[model samples]
Target: MARAAGLSRTTVSYVLNGDFRRIPEHTRQRVLAAADSLGYKPSAAARLLRGARSRLVLMVSPGLESARDTIGGDIVTRLGQLLAEADLHLVWQLGLPSVGRAATDLAPAVVLVAPTEEEAAFADLRRRFAVPVLPAFPGLGGFLAASARAQVDHLAGLGHQRLAFVRPAAPAFDLTAEFRQQAVERRASELGLPAPVILRVDDSRESAVAVLRSLRTRTDPVTSPVTAVCAYNDQVAFALLAAADDLGLAVPAEMSVIGVDGDPLGEWTTPTLTSVRSDTAAFVSDLTSQVVALARGETTTVEARLPEQARVVERSSTVGPAR
Candidate 1:
């Protein structure tokens, strides 16, 4: 194989074993093609026996149970798929102290998907374990900071003077929700729009409907009825839409609703949901690439930042307020 690729045995071994940080891309491709032609498959067990680090990628998160179908879930699911292609395995764990100890035992390259505030605790994990501790979502603080700014800008651009920032009572995810609320308020003020009304509703159809009903048919402050709402994510937005249906409120015509997480189900809603589409595919690609590189002991640079701009997919749910 080395002679076929016109490379030394060590170079071929490095390429086949995924240790190509210093190898030129062209040379790596030549070695990979040679291996493919020779039908070569590296032995993972052999590497383990030789005391090489385990090909395990541990995904740690706090709300993985309830976060299914959200952006965070998409990241974990997609990352697993990406890592598998690199001959790596993913083991998900809840961000608990016991799991932390288990992680040390496993000695896997770690991807922390926990809350932003908890990041301080993991500061020394990389040094302690001598394994990479890459971030999957760059923490909720970064995501919400970008997502919330996009939401407020989009609504204000659509001439929504009075807006409401709707959040769910998700205790595990409250830190993110609070930061998102702050982002909305800050952006709204910067755009010269009125301060947004912050509303926390239970994650239920009834609670959402009650809030939508009050916003739809209230009279004490007739001058400023909330014409638009920015939900924390698509699931919360779906609840608001269901509530609108129950109250017979005309979506977008009477109230405009926008959400984050470009969930496909958003399109099936009565008035297709307008939403901030997080670049999950791009995010997962960046994250898994870094984890795989780290696991292979390759020094490579990968950005943990979200996309420079948040893309809001316009659908029927968001439009100019009715005159």
Candidate 2:
């Protein structure tokens, strides 16, 4: 019915929200008249009693997620801070398509905190339901590319040429892998260095430890062995550190390691971790601003591609070239 009126989804949202401040008087009257004809009534009594902003944001994530990982915890904590500051309420939910979770229960909006979408049909979830469906990181591919470039660039600056990356079990929605690999290759080529190799392991401490443990027994220990690592996450970096200790391999001394996600666990490692950190605060600020702007029926032309705030905190993890 709103579509038939030749109004935008946002215009409809404004009418529903009852804040027709900017809506032209005639159009407001038409919207009201249409509502009257259609028996569209908003119960002020119910609204006053409910005391809830019909604004509910549903955060959809991958996996059953019976538990939250370390990065997940940090992101949630940061999101809560932003949501509170923005005077918004949030509800987190798993993005498992099999769960049959109903978006209908959410009052106004649904946000999927995913890198990418597998269910293409859900692209119109907003159009059909008068809600907003936002992909968290629109510049996700380039972000990953920059992240990979950060480490390689760091190693290149330090005169280390050969690097190997240890990755997590490739999540179905991994948008970063290819761009990151390409960026690594491109950087290596421009620097006249060999391309770094990627090694994938499950997103677990044990898997990370085992992969690094195996690398220590390299057959070509004399020459052309990987001297540096770009781990997928901070946890993987922790495992690599632990394995290096167990295998008696020197960090940065024998092998340098850099991790992504800027998880706090990276700090606790013995040698500390040289990591590529995300501009998470900026991301949350931009995301909340956009989502709220989108909610309030205001026009926005902002495209946020927050850059990688890559900081190479050298404690003992990374060092000068292998001499």
TM-score top scorer: 1
Q: After superposition, how far is residue 238 of candidate 2 from its true place, in Å?
A: 0.5
The all-Cα superposition gives candidate 2 an RMSD in Å to the true structure of 8.7
Candidate 1, TM-score vs. the true structure? 0.80
Alpha-carbon RMSD of each model: 3.9, 8.7
lDDT of 2 by residue, 1-323 (tens): 48656677767656655554567767766666677777877754454345424555666665425432453466566766676654355777665563244455455444645534444534644343546677655566666777777778888788787778776565642435556667777877788877676777775666766777766655554457678887766666777888788777888788888877676766688888888766556776677777766655566776555455455555568876667
Q: After superposition, how far is residue 48 of candidate 1 from its true place, in Å?
A: 3.2
Per-model TM against the reference: 0.80, 0.74
| TM-score of decoy 2 | 0.74
Model 2, position 289, has a per-residue lDDT of 73
Clashing pairs in 2: 252-255
Estimate every model's Cα lDDT from 0 to 1. Answer: 0.78, 0.65
